[model samples]
Target chain A: MILKNKDVLGLEELSAEEILGVLEIASRFRAVFDRPVRSVPIMRGRTVVNFFHEPSTRTRISFELAEKRLSADIVNFSTATSSFSKGETLRDTAENLAAMKIDMLIIRHSSPGAAHYLAKVLECSVINAGDGAHEHPTQGLLDIMTMQQRFGDLRGKKVTIIGDIAHSRVARSNIWGLNKLGAEVTLCGPPTMVPGGLARLGVNIEFDLKKAVAGADVLNVLRIQLERHSSKSFPSNREYHRMYGITEDVVRTLKPEAIVMHPGPMNRDVEISSEVADGPRQVILDQVANGVAVRMALIYLLSGGDPGALGVGQD
Target chain B: MEWSWQRIPSEFLVTGVKLCRQGKLGKRKGFLHVRKGRIEGLGIGTPTVEGIPALDGDGLVCGPGFVDLHAHFREPGHEEKETVATGSRAAAAGGYTSVVTMPNTDPAIDNTGMIRYLIDRGKEAGLCRIHPTGAVSPGRDGQGMTEFGDMVNAGAVGFTDDGSPIASGGLMSNALKYADVLGVPIITHAEDRSIVGKGCMHSGYWSARLGMAGMARAGEDAAVFRDIELAKAAGAHLHVAHVSTKGAVEIIRRAKNEGLRVTAEATPHHFSLDHSRCRDYSPLFKVNPPLREPDDVNAVADGLADGTLDCIATDHAPHTVTEKEHQFDQAPFGVVGLETALGVGITYLVNTGVMDMGQLVQCMSETPARIFNLPGGRLEEGAEADFVLFDPACQWVVDADGFQSRSRNSAYLGETLTGRVSATFRGGRLTWRDGG
Candidate 1:
């Protein structure tokens, strides 16, 4: 099945078959996304709205670009917390918008299940852009697409995610996506950065960076969220960088075929040295490039499109 | 919007009921007679009385009125969620005649006036006995002590800083000492905020798999360990609220075995659900000491079975539908439990043969009443005629819409429960009959 679900809420809910189905359709969109005058007519009349409760620059733009390329009329609902929250609640605002006849809702909220909440209240499909420290499905899908491009098969692939695993929604989503694909996922960071008990997701927990990266196929590094933690009580940046930072020397010790990835905007010389981030094998830009394609695939799939979009029925 | 109290007639007879008491069930069927708010007589056969109505208790077990040690009535503030009147109806419907309303309300029952407001409102509601627990700290801020002696004098049954623990060691010790002197048990929420930092559910593998912030077992256990030490030093009775984890259970078990004056209660959801229940991210399954692992659930059942856990409480936190329908992380934590507590206990505990009816009644009634030093929880002569009538085998599907509580956030919604509360009696009168 392309997607037996109505919403692209999280990666955790997708099965291996459903994930592969979405990725296959996404690969086709990658070609369309790369071409000049990237636009499609399949969803020309579909109305999409961006409901971002939290301030965001990157994710909203990525989703907006994907929507526009799909030829959908896009409306950005700028909900200033103060004005809308004074007399109207979120459900009321969403109901008012749904009354205007929007087709799909692309929401970036500070709360974890905001899109799911709206999906219940509204009569349209919903896409979660980013919600708190919860899953960002599109980011997870793009990262998976990037991994599949290099490895051809994610099954048995060793993927190690490093740095602030506690506060990074990116890490959480990637973990779920990578696990669903049958990859050997390893989470490496200080105890302060990585909250205990994630090993239940069937991931290897590693504190020492050297042991973590040894023979790893992909090292997905995450930026430290300073606002989310007390660096002094958690771990000092100096200490964290010294222990787990992806320095050039650390990259040299990794398996020769292993690739390095970071979901930017990167903290240069902190999580990763500029040398390794700009090194020969860095696929960080490719990950961003694939994001638009994955989101395009999601928009196509979640807008009630079936596998018939590709002239095939879920192979 | 409060319901008027129903007056008790001078005399009545409840015929052919199975009498249940502490440690054992009555050998044969019995007739119970009540006159003017007191149990007048009990005999082996049906009793004949003139000018007194007789209620048939066929296929029903009559026991001491269930006493809930912990529950949130949500009055003074958050009336949209629950009020004393609606919560009392819920309690009555759940087969409870007396419930200790926690001090976590809007103004928080920190002083004498708030306590009196609940006592008076409960009296006016005429549905259940509403005993108020005073906050251990002023404003429940965990910085300074409240008037424990004055609140107790004003009819506060116990003390607690419920929603959150008394965070400071010094403040906790001081409160413990004061409550000890006043002969009231100090209830602790038992969580170390620093260790539980930013985590929501149990810091188990399932939590990591779901990507929700995991509150470590050590977070609850460490505080439990600390509070035990504090209680020992202060010579105060420490009552652990909503015991969830195995580690905490072990510590509490050892403390009780060692005679450290410790007691604990387990919520029905804690023993019934686990962290895996949050796989779908339903806020209804979200609670304070968040549902634990499967092993922890078993340990909780074992704790109750072996008497390591002192009581079975609802922790019946009611929240508005809108509050619970928000995004999972942004949503408030809790589920309406008053109307479902007994049904769930009968379904999970008694029906499963984990504990018999006598043990269940003792935990739900006698122990809680004794712990808080409240009245009721007995069916002896001259005792207040407060009791519950229920069919242990009655099966019904849980429907939130069917709840008497103001909120519709019951965790057991859509679940099939075995026991059903038929009616509740208080002060020798029918306080709440199911259809009434």
Candidate 2:
């Protein structure tokens, strides 16, 4: 079946076949991006609203760029300056937005299931940019797309995630997407940073970074949110860097052809050293660019268009 | 002596129903006779009288009224949510004839005056019996013990510092010792607040994934363990409230096996809904000792089935619509539970085969009554005819509008349930009847 879901909530809710379909359509969009003009009028008449309750730079730019490319009118709502700052409820704010006859709503909320709640209230298509510690599906899609572009197939590929696996919505979405794509995933972090019982999801939980990175083809490192953790839950930041930090020394443990990735705003020498992040094996920058194309594909498919029927997406 | 069944002038007679008396469900068909606020008499077969007011109790179960060991009426303070009158109506609708109101009220039920108010107000409503549970601490602040002796004399059946757990080990020991001497059990909300800091839901995959803060199992288990240790030393009766985690169950089970004076309770929400239900981040799903995983839910069911848990209490906390309408993190942590407790227990426990009808009644009524040393939970000749008649096979949808509860924060709203409380009688009078 085609993507009949009106809301693109999470990767976990999407099947492997649906994920492949989105990626295939995304690959076709890259050809459009390379054009000199890089503008499509397929959605010229439609109005899309980016209602972000959480602050973001990269993800906001990525979606704005994609919506402009699709020729859809964009409405960006800043939570800091909105009626929400005046003590209005989320439902009240969302209903006011929906009254504008917006075709789609791209929401980045601090609370989990915020988008799911909005999707039920609004008649428009809802896109979850990022929701709480829940899934960031577009980020997940782009990360997997970047991996698929290089390897062609991700079946049986070993993907290792290190750093703050307990609080990373990125890690959760990636786990769902990567596992669906037949990748063997291993999550590594401190005992308190990585959640318990992930093994039930077929994930291999490793406490030692050295052991986790040994057989890895991909290392997706998460950033440490120092503000969220106390000195007790965190203990020592320097100690965390010493044991779990990704540096040139740890890079030697990976396979020769292995890649390193991060959803950034990265801490320079903490989560990854500059050498490894700027090295030839680093695909972090590519993930940012792929983010736009995958998001454009999602908007088109969820707008009730069959990407499989599009002759341009036959590849 | 053959009595005339047809010519009696009693309010109502429930005939041809099976009853769960004490712990055993009856095999023989029996008819309950009611008159002047007491069980006049009961006999087998169609009562021999035909003209009397009667209801067809075919395929239904009659038992001593359901008793909730714990609940928050929110009265004497948060009346916007519920008062004794509204809460008792909710209780009667749920087939409960008696309930122990937790001491964490507006001013907190710490004195004999509050205890007196609750009973008088509950009686005035003409619904179920509402026993005010005295706070362990004077203000429920975990500082000093309340007048347990005076409160008991004022008609309080138990003592507890429920909403805020009595965190001080020393203070809890004192409360337990004092409650024991006063002939009342000390029920406590068990969770070490220090370890549970800034956490909202159960700490696990769901909390990690949902980005919501977590209340770790160790937070609760540590408190459960410490309390059991103290109870052993004090030799006092300790009633654990809302046992949710698996580790807590193991500790409680071991305590019971060792014959310590430990009794624990589990809620329907704990045994039926898991942490995954919080995936939507509805404040409706938020609660203290928040919903746990499936394994933990099963463990609660196992605890109940194996007699490790003494009773199934509603913990019928009510909140107003405005209070619960906020975003997940911004909203309060409780849902209206009184109206749906019986339906949920029958749907999840009895129908799922985890418990039989008799076991379900014992957990809801007999056991809680026994533990608290209260009256009722039995259908005997001289006892007041406080009974709940329910259709175990009745299938109905739960709607917040249909509830007698003042607040409509039910977690089971819109779900279809297998059982319905048909009629409830308090002191031989029909206090509540479905669709009546």
**Pick by DockQ: which candidate is best?**
1
Which candidate's TM-score is highest? 1
Overall local distance difference test of candidate 1: 0.84
Per-candidate TM-score against the hidden true structure? 0.93, 0.90
Give the Å error, residue A231, model 1.
Answer: 6.5
Deviation of model 2 at A222, angstroms:
1.0
Q: Which CAPRI category fits model 1?
A: acceptable
Candidate 2 lDDT by residue in tens digits, B1-436: 2233334344567888987777778888888877777887776666765555776778878899989999899989899889899999999999999988998987999999999999999989978888889988888888998888999999999888898888899998888888898888889799898888877899887787677778999999999999999999999999999999999999999999999999999998998999988877788888887899899999999899999999999888898776676667666788778778888888898889898888988899888988998887768777888899888889999999998989988888889988889888888777788887
lDDT of 2 at B65: 90
Spell out the clash pairs found in candidate 2: B5-B49, B6-B49, B6-B50
B1-436 in candidate 1: lDDT tens per residue?
1222354456777777888887566768887888888999876777756557667788888888999999999998989988999999999988899999999988888889888889999999998889899998888988788898999988887888999977798988888888898889889999888888766677776666555777888889998999999999998999999999999999999998889999999999998998887866678888888899889999998899899999999999998777765555556778778788888888888888899888888888888898888899888889999988888788999988788999999888899998888888988777677766
